[model samples]
Target chain A: MLNYIWIGLILIGLFVAVGNDIIDEVQNPYRNGEPFVSTVLLKKAPSGIRQTWEGDLVAPPDYFNGFYGTQRTQEPIRQPAVISKSADGTASLTMNITDASPAWWREMAKSAGSKERLLGRVVEFSVSEDQTSARVQVVFESIRFVKLKAVTQAALDYAAIAVNIALGLIGIMALWLGMMKVAEEAGLLQVLTRILTPVTKRLFPDVPPDHPAVGAIIMNIAANMLGLSNAATPLGLKAMEELNKLNPKVGTATNAMVTFLAINTGGLILLPATAIAVRAAAGSSNPGIIIGTSIVGAGCATIAGIAASKLLQRLPRYKKAMEV
Target chain B: MGEFLKNLVEVISFIAIPLMFLLFLGWGLIKKVKVYEVFVEGAKDGFNVAIRIIPYLVAMLAAIGIFRASGAMELLITVLAPVTGLIGMPPETLPMALMRPLSGSGSLGIMTELMKVHGPDSLIGIMASTMYGSSETTFYVLAVYFGTVSIKNTRHAVPTGIIADVAGMLAAVWIVNLLFR
Candidate 1:
């Protein structure tokens, strides 16, 4: 029955991926380009307020004014600007000019009949004194401006659809299992009981090793640690069911299950794969830090969870359940 | 003292990462498939898991997007400025801290922005790196785990998980400070 549910979910996910075009949207490689000022260097520094690119001199263009119109060009080209070289011979150059003020930026916008304000801009050049004709690469590493809302909105809409489909598939599978009652008939309960026996004993030593509720608790934790929360639901429900099975009265919470849920919710320390994925997505040079942190952080949390549960169990109400 | 402990941790980490990967490889091989196949299967499982928890992931990602898009993250930076200042943490790292709980991708986006804003060697960038190392998606874990189990009442789970998250955050900050500062 579980196998069928798994197969069903796999099919549903495929259908959603195809039908909603979520796969395409997620894999979309569209990037936004907004207009912003960048610095470009010239063979000789312009005397007026103009942007310059920094780097080794490439072959001089026939005309600098052709690349940038006369309106964009500044006067009084600066020369041999202070070139600071690092130990590796990577030189940094800066251009000093007085006319390029915030007001000049505002006036430039006003002259262009545009309402948008101009942000600061700078040009960097790398000049190889030995190789006067070295190829110059004008790298634009930074830009500041607004983003188009339509593109972002479309991207998010596709993400929403994808998430909906995933939830729908998981929900359908959970309902099918609940309706069929395969959890009881297939002896999955017994399997879980056997699997969790030692784990329950080790994690919740205060509870009797042979307690009926231990199996359900362990199964739930295992499911969660594996990042199979949907699979964990039945185990949690079954654990609750078993806990109630032991309880003469229905609806009364058991100490063991509460502690179990607490620890499970606190989560088990297998690996922090989700965080690692995020780190990788974020473009971190190292995504492995999550592994160490997961061990230490989750390990600590598990200990704290156990300690808290034990401490809570010592209270009068919990003490009564422990006696059983 | 902290430096010694950190170096010790790094040395242990150098060994543990490879060991863990090898163990996974061994398990895959014992299952009678090539290691690459096993890895592919694992990756496929990850995709399935992502698909399964899409709603939760989306909500968290959207929240993070809103935080960034609406400039709430900037506000958070301002609010945390004094506190971070006292702790020797830079104001620029507040975005990364906020991103840690919501979406790993979102945090990474912020991390990239930070790396660009401040060079990789800057203290804030290093702390951001450490925070990325230390934290997990608390709500995503809850949603996936709880949703899987169909458990209704969160009870003590939320509090305990948050506490754990706080511990992870503090540990990352402390560890980075001790090592770098």
Candidate 2:
């Protein structure tokens, strides 16, 4: 049931987030509170008026890779940082996290105290004899509960995204629905339905051969095959509305609706345009290579879906749901 | 043959809509139907239908989003990786198979990432793209369609969709391995 599946996702997500945080707590992958030793190439020296020193923190790729136990970066890390000593003599380091930062640190920077810069406490700063470079030991601000924070953000973001998606559908939905309305009014649907009766009658035995729902269903499936999704969705919804009229019980699905939805979800398309486009963009030698494979896959899906819908509708539980 | 088929479908897709519009409205004119008034009358339902599905979509998508962001998919792939070899599936594309039925954008992201890491002509890339084309996002269609109709008790629709998704994914794996591998 949707209730169980929905709740399962929420519960599993919450538990996994907590579980991941716990694992992170034990493993300490971020090396929180651990001193990081690296050399800085100082660009600006302290003057009489200012004790702030600005430099680029540099680390060899091998050292970083070894420390993180990851092969995330090949280029050396050279990130700009400012070290300023307070009147009490404790120094703090602020590093602007840029695109050139190691992938691991950039990920940590997302949850850092400052979203843009990584804040760290200078444990020991020893200037080189030439005064142009220094070796520093610094511990970055701790990062924790990453997955949990992401989970919360995603819930909020997806809710807004969902509304945006629906709102965006208004224009396309209106366009297709209007055209479908005209087709229905002009006896065009009846003529098409008549042509597809043998197929529809077998696919949906419970529906009358001449039902308007049959017309919408045929149009919807054709739209789907053509990958005209803007048209398919509106037509499919129209089909659902018409199919609902024949339902003996309100708020429950009939055999015809199940069959129709199965076909929709099967998604038997003549061409997989999105995939092909992406393949071409990704520079495939044969971008349209998946056409045959996709057709075969979708064909199997359609047959399996139609067979499953027919077989499952006969079960006592599904049949019971249909009863008034 | 492939080039011809591609061009043929391209032409059809290009002209199909305009031709359909001309035929439908022109036929309406012949039949004495008040095309504009009838069109506006029917189009009015579009806003209502779009608005009605917002709640269902929010509920479905929010759950899926949480699941995705929690890094649970990675854990799932780790667990399912061993069984992938039994089905002739490249372990890397399992995420595509899993995400396809849940979220359209999520599966697309996986497909693109797979092709980026592996060359587009490689077996993994081809299989991932094929998997993307295999099936519709089942849960999304379920939410939107049933939400529009306000059908709370979906009965066997969920199972039917799951079966279709599984069949589609398996068929993609099977065919891709048969030809490409």
What is the number of backbone collisions in each predicted candidate, taken in the order shown?
27, 0
How far residue A215's Cα lies from its native spot in candidate 1, in Å, is 5.5
Q: What are the runs in model 1 whose C-alpha is more than 4 Å off?
A: A1-199, A202-294, A305-324, B1-68, B112-126, B148-152
Which of the numbered candidates is closest to the native, going by highest TM-score? 2
Each candidate's TM vs. the true structure?
0.45, 0.96
lDDT of 1 by residue, A1-324 (tens): 222322433344334324333332443211112222222333443234443333322222222233333333344322222233354535343333234432323333332213353222123333345533222323212221222232244347646754764556544344323321333233344555676667777665645655545655665665556545455554455455455555443433445555665565455544444444545565656655445544554556556666665566566744553343
The CA lDDT at B74 in model 2 is 91
Give residue A313's error in model 1 in angstroms: 8.5
Q: Among these predicted structures, which one has the highest lDDT? A: 2
Q: How well is each residue in A44-97 modelled by candidate 2, as lDDT tens digits?
A: 999896688899999998988887767868999898999988888899999888
Query: After TM-score superposition, what is the CA distance of residue A298 in candidate 2 from its true location, in Å?
Result: 0.5
